[model samples]
Target: MAKRFQIFLIVCLSISTVTFMLLWQGQKNNKDDIRALAQASAADACIQFTEYQTNGCESSYWYGVAAFRSFQQAYHSLTEGTNKAANYTFCNEVYGCLVLSPEISQSNISEIIETMSILSSDVEDENGYIRMSELRNSLTR
Candidate 1:
């Protein structure tokens, strides 16, 4: 009985230690993980937007809208606790785009496609955050 109890306690301690280490590691990389996810979402949105532009299908347009929303949500999550001016500005720019006009002109579609392409390119570069700031600047202008 004593031997069994000793083995059981050792097993429990090992499992708890592993769990704690995993939790600690996850916490350490939480921000990086969120950034990666947001980048991926942005890329997806860009692809969807491009498809809409190429196909000119109503469904494709809706898909692009949905993907853009996902990208926005992920970005918002990444900046939730921060009070950065750039973050707010970027969010506002994204929100303004989200409010679609009933009739999208060709120029507006071209601009959206161009913006999404820039955003997706950020995912490929190491300086994605800086690129995103640049995107905000372009949008504001």
Candidate 2:
């Protein structure tokens, strides 16, 4: 009886240790994933700004697009529940840039992201082609 009890305690301890390690690792991975996602979105925004600059869109448009792209990941990261103060600052910066210009509206990015969020999941997830079409339609108007 004593030997069995000892063995049971050891097994429980090992399981607990493993569970804690897994949770810790999972959290670390989540942070890394959020950071990567933010960077990718920022890059995409930057590319759009570059396109606007080369295509003769007004400077305001360029600024707006560039600013939007720069902070997208941060905004999404926060919205997705990171809740870091740096994320709040990033959101402010992005919001400020959009608000500074009358040539473009914040709704453009909001609409774009709204569409993206919906289409990201298969049930409501609009594919890339569908998103592009929706974006183009938004742009035309």
Candidate 3:
């Protein structure tokens, strides 16, 4: 009976240790991913700015769309385990910066890109889809 008790205790301890280690590693990985994402966001901003300057409005719009798509895909992938709020916030920050840039004034190109960025970053499930839809309708005007 004494030997059986010892074995049970040891097994419990081992399982507990392994569980803690896994949890710690998971947290560390999440932190690293967030850091990498922030760096990527900044880098994308700089590149998009340059591309817009050299490639013109149409090219710049495409770049914005591509970047948004990339973020959307990433958010969906991580939704199972990651914080959806943080993901949306990150997307919104990058989107707003790109869209609100002075280089994309209404006199030349559509300013709806800025609004779309704002909508995409919404945490309360209020992505500016309605506004974006309206803007699209006005594009032919």
The clash count of every prediction, one per candidate, is 0, 4, 1
Pairs with backbone N, CA or C atoms under 3 Å apart (clashes), candidate 1: none
TM-score of each: 0.59, 0.40, 0.39
Those runs of model 2 whose alpha carbons end farther than 4 Å from true positions after fitting are: 1-14, 21-26, 56-70, 73-91, 99-141
CA shift at 24, candidate 2, in angstroms? Answer: 2.8
Rank candidates by lDDT, best first.
Answer: 1, 2, 3
When sorted by TM-score, best at the front, the candidate numbers are 1, 2, 3
- Model 2 pairs in collision: 38-73, 45-69, 119-125, 119-126
* lDDT string, candidate 1, 1-141, tens digits: 999999999999999999999999889658777667767777776777677778877676667667766767766677766665465466556545445442432235566666666656664343444545555455445
Model 2 Cα lDDT, one tens digit per residue, 110-136: 554543343233211225335535554
Output candidate 2 Cα RMSD: 12.4
Cα TM-score of candidate 2: 0.40
Q: Is candidate 1 or candidate 3 better by TM-score?
A: 1
Off by over 4 Å in 1: 1-29, 83-89, 96-107, 123-141
Best-matching candidate per lDDT: 1
Which structure among the candidates has the greatest TM-score? 1
